[model samples]
Target: MKPRICYTVWFSQRNRSTLLCEGLTATGIAGKPAELLELPPATSLLDFYQVNDYAALQAKLWQQRMTENGVFGMKANAPRKESDPIIGQLAKLSGLKVAAPTPYAVWENAFPNGKHIFLTRRNKIRQAVSWWKAIVTGQWHLEKGGERKVDSQVISQHYNFEAIKHLLLEISLRESKIQAFLEEGNIVPLTVVYEDFVKQYQQSIRSVIDFLGITDTQYPIKEPHYERLADELSDQWVERFRIQLQKDWKNVIW
Candidate 1:
């Protein structure tokens, strides 16, 4: 029997999805929505997921990530562009003859009949800074009770202004493209804001529960599983990025 997929939460970098997915899993009714089909680090899309194909992905999920209740949830980072590696990853593994590059098209076999959730961060510069920091440090998320420390080598000389700026553009462009995809598909996703969710986590989880329309009693809410990485250095980069933006462009920050 085919496993039922309840929804696919779409996002990009630095949206704090790890924490939110933890919260949602705690709810028990949402099932465990894990990034089961993600592209591996340091591997290009064309180079991976081809041999195993889509059946392998499902088998992997059923054996590991899928819940016993027959409710499955998944998450995917929105493609930065049509040419994004993720599209190729999905298309090849999908084992379907999907010509389009968007995830919705490639995962049509797995995506349809599932709801959509779009997560976004309100602060673009901060998100970009976080993305670049993680890329440089090779530490995307910190587990709960983990020390919020940046690598010593990274802070001294790894701060590249242009790299962060380029990431900011990538983040922004991908967001625009995702919005269009949702609009074109007439898909209304439950949009969650990172800052607001962090401020009122319990309430935010409740909102997600309500969106899922589940009547089961939720498990006791607990402290978030992941810690935020934003620090003084993060702030410093944000301000520096803004200053550079002002110096290079006109009326951008006013």
Candidate 2:
């Protein structure tokens, strides 16, 4: 049978879906649903620059997790770039003969029966500041052992109101687009709040397993091996951003 698909729509960069992904894969009932489309080293089935048969490529990807009752979980980051690269990749794969694709169209095409999970944060200000901090510090993620994914030399961090403002609006726009797409498609996704998921790690994971209808609930859940990157500086930025945002009368995004 074709593998059941679980598509996670990440609101922004720091949605902490890695923890959720870890919990799902630890069950061994869900196949690895990583970003095979991301650039750098291409996944085997998608040697996009050379491969000509788009149909066969899609077929190979679909068959990767096929099993009796296995679920394939994949996540897509926010569409903050100038163009939706996923759609671009798919268009190239299709030889550009058809109509240009929308984000939801590409998702639906990949997994016709895919179930969606919406990863969001209630505090948009904090979420935006968290993203800005990572950019300034050059530390994208932190490991539990205190290791950091950082640059060769640590960049001195600073608070830039414009940068945070741009990110805040981008996040707002992303949430709006995602909700509109799901509503248009009549899809109800499992909404996982970043704030709540971090606090109720096990419960959130169980909820996802339940959403996917996985029967392996008795297995022990796995927590994220990474640590929360937020600190006193992050909190300060959150407060500063909210205060600075007062000048803008279009406070709907805040």
Candidate 3:
């Protein structure tokens, strides 16, 4: 039986997920290269507002799998707090494992048998700014035009300075989750830092190939175009936001 690979992305928006997904597709795991969202056909006209029922949705996905000739990949943002339990139950019924980035330690704990992969970025402030841009431009989500009210208390709770530091914390948490899995010897997970993955794409891909137990004779990993932000935000603004984020990050974690 062919190995089934499900990639779980944990970032907010506009991160390097597209490049990673494209890379997997080019290597033939996805059969044909396309963005992550291209998988699992649209189930309803209301999909923009919400997802269809889990069991029915998975049934549709399983049906689609009959025609594909390689490992399957499905991507989604963080599961909604309310829907998580149902999704977990459905995954149990379908024999699928959840794959996602490192910061999902809490969620990973909930799905103890799930597989995990961590992707970290070097410049988090740039990432945050990019996330903001994607949100504003309607690429991440549709935002209605208005003066967006910034909740000072909420911002204080989750913001972190030096975006890289936040990235590191996320990495640390993911490493912890990986260690837990290792200690139990139930699953062996893979970790990929964004910088290292980019610098040594082939090596990273080989590591993933080994972890997934893919045959060397069959699917080989490929590199795809990793798009970078064309222009960076002003240093002064970045610094200011960084300070705010630092305070919030500290509050939430420590």
Candidate 4:
């Protein structure tokens, strides 16, 4: 066996993972990544793959989508505790090979010998706001022809200080954890930041394709037709959060 090559994107919510995945899917080389609808037990995987044994289903799917060069890809953002049953299940699955989950190192061990992409955002405030907005709106993504309307009733156009604070803390911790994991792994991933990707999309796309060892001629790559969900309210919330962080949460380093 020429090594079951699978690329994994280690990311958290509201980090432009969807946008990146969409772009990659457009390239026709990378298999779109999957996310757990809720948490473990991810019984949904059975329906997603339409099989009882998710392990076997994933194996077959990987083999089917894998190129001659031995590359298949998916997105992962699961609990990283060694005791978590989800980790065990993922370990048994064909693609993810998480041997242990200590701190934020689960992803590192999962694909020890496989290519990984560390997708993130630099603006923690914006990231947190986006997450909260998504939770309230219940719209994680907007397709090209999809409706642009966001459900105001979800969050009620009101800024929940507690929600924003919690999200900010979560995003900060995850970002720090990911950094530590990357350093420990001693692997420099093809880092994609949300801000940078949008600024230099064409170059970014090419870089990801090259990293995947796929020839440009292999797929007709096209730019994704999507827009950022952040609006004026998002900006206002980010500003408010920043002020709050500076005032009462000054001791906390985000």
Tens-place lDDT digits, model 2, residues 107-127: 676665678788898888888
Native-to-model Cα distance after best TM-score fit, residue 55 in candidate 2, in Å: 2.6
Which residue runs does candidate 4 get wrong by more than 4 Å?
1-4, 36-58, 61-69, 92-113, 151-156, 216-218, 248-254
Candidate order, lDDT descending: 1, 2, 4, 3
lDDT of 4 by residue, 54-147 (tens): 5555555565445555566767663454365555554554444344545335443344346878888888778888999888877887767788
* Cα-based TM-score, every candidate: 0.80, 0.79, 0.53, 0.77
lDDT of 1 by residue, 94-176 (tens): 44664654556665554545677899999988999999888877788888778746654467467788998899898888778
Q: Of the candidates numbered 1 and 3, which has the greater lDDT value?
A: 1
lDDT of 2: 0.69
RMSD of 2: 4.5
The CA-based lDDT of model 4 is what?
Answer: 0.67
Ranking by TM-score: 1, 2, 4, 3
Worst 10 residues of 1 by lDDT: 44-53
Please give the TM-score that candidate 2 achieves against the real structure: 0.79
lDDT of each: 0.73, 0.69, 0.46, 0.67
Score residue 6 of candidate 2 by CA lDDT: 50
TM-score pick, better of 1 and 2: 1
